[model samples]
Target: MIYLDYVSTTPLNQEVNHMYQSLLNDYFANADSLYSLGLKTSALMEKSRELTAQLLHVLPEEIIFTSGASESNSAAIKGCAFQYQNRGKHIITTAVEHSSVYQSCIQLRDVFGFEVDFISVDASGNLDLKQLEEAIRPDTILITMMYVNNEVGMVFPIEKVYQMIQKINPKIKLHVDMVQALGKMPIDLTHVDLASFSAHKIYGLKGSGVLYKKTSTSLVPLINGGQQEHQLRGGTSNTATHTMFAKTLRLALENLEQKYQYVTSLNHYIREQLTQIPDIVINTPSEHVSPYILNFSCVGYKPEVILHALEMYECYVSTKSTCSSHKSDISRTLQAMGIREDIAKSAIRISFSHHTTQDELDEFLFYLKKTLKTIKKQR
Candidate 1:
């Protein structure tokens, strides 16, 4: 099948796979053990952490390893909210964030009586800075938003937003869910205080993730056990997974420019092809969106209809975030962008990777055109 869902997860790269296997064989000892083998494993884990921090342009102590983006996000959001509950009970975020974030705010409100203000978005899924500024108040203690939206591929103006929030309330901690943007965009944590990223999104093993907390900010640990990860997260370190995460991140950074160009070419080609059809509406903006993901509505067609049609053509895609793929609710991102409900229901995401070839795009365009035609006929 043609895999067009890199936004969900990417396959492990050969180099990362080799590192994972090698580390599993040689560094199986617990990183916290006092034995010689354990000490060696601990050293390797620390080295990986240091390498990851260097890539993120932060100190090694700032990187906290977790199971995945979900865990890191949970730790960052809940950890900060709970830790600073006495200081404030209000938070700010966008309406188009992933379920891990949106749902965390919901739970925080219900469980802790914390108030959450959701900033609105425009038609291209861009958050309004004015709305965000108005949403902040003296009680607001945290502002968390995703760097790149998972489903719609819109890149938030994170640096500008961070600066704005810092100007208003320098003590208000800023957290970023950088899961989708880790490999696709540049991430320098010098400005962002708390950022979460996962390895599987960049062709590494699953269950390996990082949460960067700037030295100035402090958070309560969500997990209580061993002192691993600076006592922020518990459990013995998964040495192999950590090594593989570092390997994949290093490779992605080395090929960043090349991959960006490749994905941009693919997105442009697909946009060119879709424009000829005249029946589809590109939900994502051509100029401001990420090159790796494309979201659009198949006019006169529901997403389920087009999805079924594409499956017959052996082309795989998705309708929304993988975390909420099973839910039939209208995409919160599209809705927040002021898109009509009918168009939102018809919206689908076609995400690609640097490995995707031009020929693959040609074939996909052909099948997609055919599917659209079939969908039109049935309607």
Candidate 2:
């Protein structure tokens, strides 16, 4: 299939797959065992952690391996809320966050009795920093938002937000969900207290991801088991997959500028063609959006109709964040941006990768046009 859903997840990198197989075979011993083989395996995992930290410009001790961003987001939000509730029971987040961050914030407010402020975004999918600043109060303990929005690809002004929050309440922890921004955008977690990422989003195997927690930040454990993940998260990890993730992250960051430029050309091509279509309404902002992801509405047409139509031609795409796409038909992100309900209901996302070829995109556009025309005829 001609896949266009890189933001949801990517096929494993062939090189990373090879590394995983090699590590799996060589490091079969339990990392916690006292035996020599176990010690060797544990040491290798530590090296993997160091390499991953070095690539991300953070300390190895700050990185905690998790199942994926979902777990990381939940752990970061709930842990911070639980740890600092005595100091304050208030938190801040945006309306356009990924499901993991959004739901985690909701759970904090509903079940944990912590007050939450859902910061609003403009019609262009940009957050109002001034409003966000006003929402911060003495009781606010954390501010969690996405580095890049998953559905519309709107990049948040994270550094500015962090600086603002620091000035207001230096103790307020800043947690950023960086899942979609991993390989698609520049990253600097120097001032961020916590950040979350998923391996599957970056051509790495699933069931492995990273949660960077600053050394100074205090967070309660989300799980209690074999004392893994620095006691933040417990249970045995997929040591083989986690160990090979360093190489996977390295490969994703390599030649990022070249990859970005190439993908920008693809996005430009798709955007140009998509705008020419009669009933299309681009939901992704024209400016300040990542080229790796694009969003729009197939006006008056159910997104699934067009999606299935393209699928018949062996083209794959997504209607929204795959994790919660089945949970809701309408795009909550679009609606939060002030889009009309009908338009929001018909919204779909087309995500790209550096490996997506111009020829492949041309074929994709052909199939899209054909699908649209066929639907028009049926109507």
Candidate 3:
């Protein structure tokens, strides 16, 4: 199968998989136990934390491992809101965030009585900085935004936004959902207060994730039980999976530049070929977007129909974020960008991994054109 849904999740790296298997067999003790085997497992888990912190340029104490990005996002947004609500009850975020971030904010608004200001994005899914600046009030205690848009792969100006927020209110916390940016780009945590990451996105184990909370930052425990994850999250540490994630992250960063160059070229090739197809409208902006994802609309065709047609040819693609793929509604990212409902409903997202080959892309393009022709004839 020609897998084009890397944004949803990546295949496990064989090396990382091997590490996971080895660790699971050797270090099966509970990390929190006081026994010798448990102590060794706990030490290994701390080592994994240190490695992840090194990658993000943060301290070992700042990295909190979780199930995945969804849990990390929930912990960052909800935990911060609950812990700092005494300081302020208002939070700011963008409209194009992942479902996890968006829903977390919604829960704060509906259940916790916090006021949320959702900034708008342009047609290309770029946030309006001016609106963001204007939305910050004295009661704005936190700002949650995504580093890279999942649907279109638009990279948000995170550093700039953080700096701007600091200038306006140094006390306000900034939380970034960096699930899509982890291995695809260089991540600097110098200005960020908090950020979330997922291991599966970088060819690591599915159950591992990371939340970077600056040393000075504070959050209420999402899962309260034991003293795991520096008291930010509670439960028995998934020692094996977290260790495997750190190894995968290190490997991914080692080849970051090389993979970027290769993927950029592949993206350009797809963009050029897609332009030649009639009724195809590229939704992803030519600039200010990650080379890993390309979202476009087939004017007369519905996304579900196109998805099934491509499936027949063993070309797997997607309509939107994998978390929201089961929903029949239009793309929230497209709607937030002010795209027409018809175009939004017809949008298809094609994401790439470093392992995707030129020949695979060529095959996909052939099937895509054939599918379009077949659909047209049926009409």
Candidate 4:
């Protein structure tokens, strides 16, 4: 099968799998137990945290391991709101964020009565800085945005946003979802207050993730059954997965620059070929976008039609974020960029990994064009 859905999830890297297996079989003791075996396991976990922290350039204590990015996003947003509510109840975010961030913000506004301002993006999927500045208030507590958009690969200007926040409200916290950006590009979280990452997004195991909370930043615990992750999250830990986080990150970042340049050529090849097709419009912008993902629309055809037709040839792609791809809604991400309804409703997302090849892309295109022709005849 030609799999082109890396943004949704990636197959586990063999090296990371080996690390996980070693820990699972020999070091299975609970990290929190007071016994000698548990103490040794706890040391291993701390070492993992230290290495992950060093790689990400943060304090070891700052890394809070959780189930995945969705839980991390919810914990960061809600925990911040609850812990620091006395400071403010207002928050700011972009309209094109992943569903995890968008829905978390929605929960704050709809269920908890917090004021949320979702800043809209321009047609090219870039945020309006002036509009963002106007939206910030004395009560605005946090601004959560994604580092790289999963659907269209738009890279939000988090540095500029951080600078703007310092000028407007020095107290406001900045949180970013780094799932799509973590393995695709280098990250510096020095100026960021909180960030979320999923191991699965970077070719590691699923059901494991990290939330980087600055040492000085205070967040009320999101989970409270016991004292783990500095009372931030509760429950028995997934020891094997958590301990291998550092290796997972290390392998993903290896040769990243070379991998990126090679993938750019692949993306360029597909983008050129897709533009020549009838009734197809590219949704991903050419500028300030990650080369790992490309999105386009087959205007007259529903996404499900094209997807099913392509599946007959064992080709695979996706629509928008996988969190909401199963639903029939038009892409809110494309809609926020002011794309036409015909295009937005028919958007298809194709993501790539360094493992993707030119031959796979060529075969994918052959099947894709054949599917479009079949649909045209049906019409």
Ranking, lDDT, top scorer first = 4, 3, 2, 1
For TM-score, candidate 1 versus 4, the one ahead is 4
C-alpha TM-scores of all predictions: 0.96, 0.97, 0.98, 0.98
Clashes in each model (backbone N, CA, C under 3 Å)? Answer: 0, 0, 0, 0
lDDT score for residue 97 of model 2: 84
Model 2 per-residue lDDT tens digits across residues 101-171: 88998998889898999999999988989899999999999999998898999999988998897788899
* All candidates: CA RMSD (Å): 1.4, 1.3, 1.2, 1.2
Q: Report the C-alpha lDDT of model 3 over 1-379, residue by residue, as the tens digit.
A: 9999999989888998887888989999999899999999988988988988887788999999899999999999999999899988999999898999999999999998999999999986779999999999999999999988999989999888988987899999999999998888999888888999999998888878998899899999889988888877777888898777678889889878899999999999999999999989999998889999999999878788889999998999998888998999987889999998777878999999888999999999999998998885323
- Global Cα lDDT for candidate 4: 0.91
Q: For model 4, what is the alpha-carbon lDDT of residue 269? A: 99
Q: Rate the local accuracy (lDDT) of all candidates.
A: 0.87, 0.89, 0.90, 0.91
TM-score of 1: 0.96
Question: How high a TM-score does candidate 4 get?
Answer: 0.98
Candidate 1 off by > 4 Å:
375-379
Residue 114's C-alpha lDDT in candidate 1?
96
What's the CA error at residue 198 for candidate 1, in Å?
0.7
Report lDDT (Cα) of residue 359, candidate 3: 96
Question: What's the residue-level lDDT of 310 in candidate 4?
Answer: 88
lDDT of 3: 0.90
